[model samples]
Target: MTPPELDRKSALFLDLDGTLLEIAATPEQVVVPPGLPSLLAHLHHQLEGAVAIVTGRPLAQTDELLRPFSASAAGEHGVSLRYADGTREELPAGIAVPSAWREELEAAVQRWPGVLVEPKPHGFAVHYRLAPEYGNEVWRLVRQLVPPEHPWFHLVPAREAVEIGLRSASKGHAVERLMAHAPFHGRRPIFIGDDFTDEAGMRKARELGGIGLRVAEVFGGDPANVRAWLMEGAQRLDGRSASSIPTGVTP
Candidate 1:
């Protein structure tokens, strides 16, 4: 079920970009909202340790953004998690894409004036925010490089890019695993995100009896507006936006 209709004993699953931090031209340009860590800490206390960030980012990156709060963080779309006990676990590695295919896609991206590729252990992201008009062309080429029927790899859409990754892993799997684990168990699931990649986590939360709160739009908007939108979304989930939760999006 959606938020407001969720049962009291639910968990909180949040997204990072567009949801917590404002989105940027490049992935690296995104800024973590100030004071989010403190807000997360308070929310954790309020929830009794039932909250966590479930995102598509890598685990280390997620931790860096939420360092101030130092709470549990998940990365690689839930393929990894840093628990409240300070333990780390990397979920199963995803299907390996052929190196030749990756190279071919990267080389082809160079022809696109404003697109850039983001490399991941099991996936790649083609970003086109700098030139939105090139998106369709970039997508067409990327799709050609990785066919839809490919068994091990698939193309997943994000806000400003398309991601190619192992089909076996996803944010949904992470939510399932986290829900079955300690501190996060028995609580209702609540997920927040702002991209198409986050849809899996949102669906998982709904299936598990929780809610997904999608962050406001962030692309091509004023920085101040983006920040305000992010803060507003956070406030809905935690009752306060900036200083209410240990922040980061991962897994």
Candidate 2:
């Protein structure tokens, strides 16, 4: 299906790593292009506050990467959410990981040379991106450390990482919550992402009468192309003719 036009009527939800920005060896090492902040600001204006970054990164990290302009966002796979008006919400305190589990994860990471443990308010993640050879090891450790029948937490295998978080909160839930509010309530939802974790948000977008554009072979599997498409969309929204916009992939 053709994606909804990038206009005021559509609500745009974008993933961060590997979608808006190229994936780096380490999450902290990803580079934000010079003009991306400005471009995103323009798109947010054009969409009338319908633009948001739906990402796995924490809100603080997302803000650090896309500084000078803050859009609505859902972070930590939807464990936290900040609306357009700046109101924030997060998974309840009841869902937090136990201290014992946190210690176990930290100890496990110490055993792996390049593995990193990122602890969130609600859960934790073991990233093996830097040590690809230890991916299976990381997964195995997580499985053994975290009980299979844990009531509140569940394991989410994402790109080069395994995240254990609240079972209830998810990208799909995030999208649903955003769509229930003003500006986004009536608008069609468009989700752009490039990972298995993003599939939830993509499916939610389609359920809301919009399309999900996967960043893969179709768009050259490059985040640069996604950026170009966004820039062109912003330009078109600024009253430029569609014909003046570069063609290839349409967002």
Off by over 4 Å in 2: 1-4, 241-251
lDDT of 2 by residue, 65-174 (tens): 98987989999889899998899998654567888977887887787889988877777788898888989888887787677797777899888988988888888899
User: What clash count does candidate 2 reach?
Assistant: 0
Instruction: Provide the global lDDT of candidate 2 against the true structure.
Output: 0.84
- Give per-residue CA lDDT, model 1, range 35-136, as digits (tens): 666556655766677778877777767777777666676776766777778887765554566788778877877787888888776667788989888898
TM-score of every prediction relative to native: 0.79, 0.91
Candidate 1, residue 178: how far the Cα is off, in Å: 0.4
RMSD of each: 5.1, 3.5
